[model samples]
Target: MPTRPLSNEVLQKTIDVYIASMRSWTDSAKKLGIARSTLEHRLKVAKRRGMLGPMPKALDGFEVKEYSEQIGKNGEVKSRSTKYSPEGGGQFEVPDGYKIKGESVLTDADGQIRARWVKTKEGEEDPLQVASVVRGAFEGFVAKSPNIWRLKDHDEDSLTVYPLADFHLGMFAWSKETEGPDWDLKIAERVLTETFQELVERAPKSRKAVILGLGDLMHADSHKNQTPGSGNIMDVDTRYQKVLPKLCDIIIQCTEFVRHKHAEVEAEFKAGNHDPASTVAIRTGLDLYYRNDKHMTVNTSPSPFWWHGFGVNMLCGTHGDGAKIKDLPGIMASYKREMWGSSKSCHAFTGHVHHELCTEKDGTRVYSLRAPIPSDAWHSAEGYLSGRSMYGFHFHKDKGSTGRSEVEIL
Candidate 1:
């Protein structure tokens, strides 16, 4: 007798029973009142229809309106296409390995707004994905042999902060075009390392040191050589793969240098408009590299803002691209209420405009540090020139704003 076709509901129920029965063909077949062959055939049909394995589920704040999968000859999923519709007002989610290709909206006669987002398989690896892969590989390599350095003795009451703002690693700038010092990967590494070493040597011997990256650590966020937020084209020095490793190397070098000078070193890299994802990758690498070192603390938080409390002083830092400088004090107070209330002196360090600006509001002083890197082609063409420099601020436990050491690039 020919076998009758089973409905989707029946097939799904069989599959569920089969799974619940621990994938025993005899048990599932008996429970479903079907022959073993019939059960197997139904499973084959379900697999062919892309219903055997985990199906695409609805994303948060959105519902999966449509889902299709391309099956290869070997029964492997070649690609996936999904259409998502927002359940309500808010941002929609994109399925993994998919990118938003197009969007459409329909307005019914009843005046209901229905929007659909078509997402296709992403052809290129996302920057954050690439970072994750690289970070894993790096973690594996560094885990075998951990390097722990000796700590130094220094003043316990003082905390020194090395503010590295807008280093712009991987940026390309010609001296003639930008009317500034020529910069590239090699030059940037040399200038940053050399300048930081000089600053470290000149800085007072504090027990704790903060290597604060005030943002724009990389000229480009990803392989696309464009700003992450604005999508503006950037003048890049080389491929992103090469630049990312070099970024980790520079940070490692700076941290090592600081470790020798201070007993405890805390490193934090903020996400700038250009290198938000890159900063995460860099910090991940740093954390993995220094995971075994008890004296080194790497802040790998994905938050845009970072803060540290030392003695009676509180130091906060941000990329300075989101909130206004004047508003930072209120933000700090609100975000870090305990730290704000306990500390006698509060200071927020920021970098984005690439110039020095010191302003006090509501008892918190916000300082926008200057970048050591010269202006790139875009900034130069726009006549946005500023003095190039880096600074290290020192804070006394009881007294605040003791002094600072500066490195001016001439």
Candidate 2:
């Protein structure tokens, strides 16, 4: 009898192929020509790596303003500013480096005091120290949110990539349900829009963007004719109408933000297993947009990610769906041989798995993004242990890679 390769070879091949199509063992085994038990063994490793996540950081405090004070010679009409004095309140006189040429400055917030004197003896403690104290009732006033998207005051020019993978718009969850109806297009729009705003806020300094989508756009269950379970989402026409407008709206908002920093902003849409219909639909939608007043060329499907006049040497992509998740590497390698069949390099992004991955094959960097769903917790139903910390990435010549900020809805 012919012998199969070593255990390691099969294991590696198994890990490479799995994707949205075969998230579970039964599906994976059937596709890979392996026994369900063998597939299960290989997948134990996939599940392990899929669970990688970043350590959580404590929330940052929001600075709030409350009380107002005036500081100066009385007739001069000096405004005393009250601020938070983290150190403590003391009779420290203000010193020479006066930002404002005022007689004195007083900023007092409830728990801290900040006062600086413009004119002072050269040998005195710096007056900037005095401005920290704040005097006011730290009560009743609603403070800002503590959740921040990105580092405060980080000015670095970096190209980041965000993969919006496998948002099967016209699809609904079979088992997962959330705040409202599962797969309700209306609720999904709100959630996705809010997430985009938060992601942009998280990395405001990001200059260039690689926005790609992992397929399964329509939830047309290519693997199986999914029975209409509790959340069986398949109202194609209505769902498309609801989702299409919202997607364009979200894309427009993200594009507006992208154009502000990165001159070369492009979005790519890779088809997924579920939404083969989306290929035709999204293109039509973009065509309508272009024919309208905007007059901007908003590229659409068949090409997943937008190159945005970046470079033709490398083709940008989205949702790399061909086989099950356990067999992605094998599937991708097959694509390299059977499809691309070239010695050139490319960059691609895919979503379907609802997890984050960064791997280099041949020369292309295939970024499998981490999806942010309200029900990311429900992946337990898939018999896998994946975390929801994956965001997007940015490529830079100097820094190598940056910008994979977590998506948030706050």
In model 1, state the lDDT of residue 49. Answer: 43
**What's each prediction's TM-score?**
0.63, 0.45
lDDT of each residue in 1-410, candidate 1, tens digit only: 11233456776798899999999999999999989887887786555344564555444444445677999999999998867665445456677777767666665443334544455567677899899988888874633122333445588888899987888889899999998889999998988888887888788888889999888888888899988877888889899999989988888888888898889889998999888888888888999999999999998888889898877898899999999999999999899899888999999999999999999997889999899888889999999989988789999998877889998988
- Candidate 2 local distance difference test against the native: 0.49
Clashing pairs in 1: none
RMSD of each: 27.1, 38.2
Please name the candidate that would achieve the greatest TM-score relative to the true structure.
1
Point out where model 2 deviates above 4 Å.
1-158, 170-183, 204-207, 220-240, 287-297, 301-315, 323-347, 360-365, 374-381, 384-386, 397-399, 408-410
The Cα local distance difference test for each model comes to: 0.83, 0.49
Model 2, range 54-134, lDDT digits (tens) per residue?
112111221222335455676563664433212323344444443333355465432122454444334544455544322
| lDDT score, candidate 1, position 114 | 50
Please list the residue runs of candidate 1 whose C-alpha ends up more than 4 Å from where it truly belongs after superposition: 1-153
Q: Alpha-carbon error at 328 in model 1, in Å? A: 0.5
